[model samples]
Target: VWHKCVDIVTAGLKRVAEIGTMMPDPHGYRRYCFTPLVAWTADLPEQLMIACVSKSASPVTEATHKQFGDSHSHSSRTGDLTLQRIEQVARGTHPWNNLSRFQREAKTIQLSGVHLPFWRNWPFADPSIFLLPEILHTCHKFFFDHVLSWCRELLEDDLDARFKCHHKRVAVRHFAGGVSHIKQMTGREHRDIQRTIVPMIAGCVPPRFLRAIRAIISFIYQAQSPIHTDTSVKEMESSLQEFHAHKDAIIEANARKTRSAGTKNDFHIPKLELFHSFAAAIRNNSGLIQYTADVSERLLITHCKRPFERTNKNKD
Candidate 1:
């Protein structure tokens, strides 16, 4: 019988091999496998209350109406990126208008309105901390990066455009459907086009963690568990070497894009790229990167930039 370690290490060692290794399920919504570490979620900002006093705009308490009064800026270390963007998008408006609880006199004009649904619930867009265990578990369950790579292919191909367009159409349909429908047909309704386009997108392996339990189980099943030998150790070494190679390949691939597209990535796409790969391998082109992507004092400050007056009268 083959050794357990040898089996898994063998699978991992063959990075280019098609071993049907079950990696993590990116589609999982209920399982809280890996938790974001730095998230320290609870300590971050939750709600901001903008007291709308109609007494000719009297400044409220310092705790309430401070520098970030209208602007609900949270600790970046703990702030959710997506939430912050929504706050930004809501723009210079009252974020806490909906959750305000103030007792006003009969003459005070007081009512509440929320600029967006949640004050700052989307964290994926910001710097997120994911549990290594979860990533590992996922890698094992999904069997290397095959599933993830497949998803990325779809995204770069039919899935990304189709999903984006479909979502856009759906959104427009809710308020202005007829206009978008007239523009083009939805992606799903046309199978021939989708099949033709899928092959063109890039592909990658799903993320990995060598010792993921599910992966361990499958590898063990393929061989003899609770067993180890010199061969197993050698196999593991080979796997690690291949791991480094694949990592370099992925970096090189993404790096090419950066060089080609002069615009620097304001946010990291590694995780999203991993998501793409996972979705693709499962042959499921439909996937979403549930994360945030905007948070910049520079950008925000720039948005507040005003025009400088030029005085060149006689020259022209």
Candidate 2:
């Protein structure tokens, strides 16, 4: 059903890409306009859906759950490669002739069995290139979901207590009741927590664990910077390397756990692997800040939420 919907919506996009469109400029001169999908602003899960990859696979890279924690970036997965895989499955050569065999092949390659994706025929658009990094979900949510959990495991109550005791300042958020008590957390709250988290956990955790936290926080801030240079991007890369080097401390402390079993320590986080692609994304699509979801989030409130709230509760 979702794929059908996508095909319906993207039919026009595919047409536009194939033949281009005609539009008038501000001066009223008609010009040929080539509309290609340059960027797709979505969180990781949605990105997986659009890219037609499995949940455990990365949309941009070849990294799967097993290789997610690798310090270096993996080879990117291009639209051509994805389409080729789909074609292979469709062909159903000797081993993959049967349904079970086909399913197994698709699973092995992490294809979602989406024989025809929305962007399959779109011009000048590659999911690996255009499915850009979003700071709001990728960075802030990752900190709150993964890093904060590890901190809580190590520091326990002391982590929250430290947040409670931290001195307040003008224009800075002070967690008077600590973060744990907060029933809901927004991106703003996530930023506030990240702003003070490194210092708050200082001297409380092991040296490697503290270093890991510091490095990731640094990477997030650097990635969010409004402007970027070659040097700045390199610095971001260095910060990620530092974090990966020290991340074992979290596993050693039993802070990181397997999501499925929860019995064993693990570092196979997809978001962490997503970090490796940011530098390339910046080069390909300019600064990461340009693709942030903050603006869209604000628009959602103004355009969707307020309008819906004014409607009657009974499906108005």
Candidate 3:
């Protein structure tokens, strides 16, 4: 389906470019040719496209055949050919066009047989140009949810007990000058605490956690309402870097606890490895992050869902 769509769009763009049929800008300068920059943005599962392409099966199956010395078990060809790897190649980091570790891996996997159809033609000739990191799912959801999880776990008992009777008062005082009102620390109220309240009570949060919180809010606001200037992009990059640093600090702080917990899953807490996508988005098109942000999707769920439905789901 992606292949077909690309073929049709690429053909149309070429035809219009050749015929000189583009609409003029405000300055009345006619522009005929336009290379459509393709970008794919969705939640992590959809964006990663695990097991979506056919080639993912071949190499693993071949490996199994060699190892077992028995031809009976069909090869289960599945491994990590992540979007990050592809995007790295697109951005000139993964060495797809050169000889390096990435190239070596590509060769080992029989790169020629990789079957992502969009990579075959124009416009999508470069996967990096088309498949972008969506800030909404990548940054907003992960960053905020990670922060929310920590906050809820750390403060839920204390806040509920301490502010049992005066929760509304605290919210009213905090947001007195603003239109917002919060009677309970639930859902968006939790988000609001992370965004607005956390900064105000920075002293209460550990320095490492406070820094991460500030970095996240800064990046999200800047992405949603970008300045559309080079400096703004740089600032976004800086904030993202700071967020990553603080995230590392928090992870390090938890490393000892996680180790002692003796859990097989080493990543006991959320990881900020995906934050690289935010930097990629800044480089590709800084201003466009707003369009792909998670704010709208979150708003849709909050507004569209009926009260009864939410109550029933919670009860179940």
Best by TM-score: 2
Q: Which stretches of candidate 1 lie over 4 Å from their true place?
A: 1-138, 141-155, 158-226, 255-316
lDDT of 1 by residue, 1-316 (tens): 1223333544433432322334456775443232212221111111112121122221121111122212111222222433343344344444344223222221132112323322122223122222111222222222222322323432344434443344333212221221113223332222222222223232322343222212322321222222345565345334333443343333333421333454322223222112212211122111111111112323443553322123333444
Query: Rank by TM-score, descending?
Result: 2, 3, 1
RMSD after CA superposition, every candidate:
24.7, 2.8, 12.0
Error of 3 at 238 (Å): 2.6
User: In model 3, which runs have C-alpha deviations exceeding 4 angstroms?
Assistant: 1-31, 50-116, 159-191, 252-271, 277-280, 293-316
How many pairs in model 3 have backbone atoms within 3 A of each other, for residues 3 or more apart or on separate chains, i.e. clashes?
Answer: 2
Scored against the true structure, residue 70 in model 2 reaches a CA lDDT of 91
After superposition, the stretches of candidate 2 with alpha carbons farther than 4 Å from their true spots are: 26-29, 93-105, 258-260, 314-316
Q: Residue 43: error of model 1 in Å?
A: 22
Candidate 3 lDDT (Cα, 0 to 1): 0.47
Candidate 2 C-alpha lDDT tens digits along 86-122? 7887787433356566666777789876666878778
Better of 1 and 2 by lDDT: 2
Worst 10 residues of 1 by lDDT: 39-48
Question: Where is model 2 poorest over a 10-residue stretch in terms of lDDT?
Answer: 93-102
lDDT of 2 at 284: 86
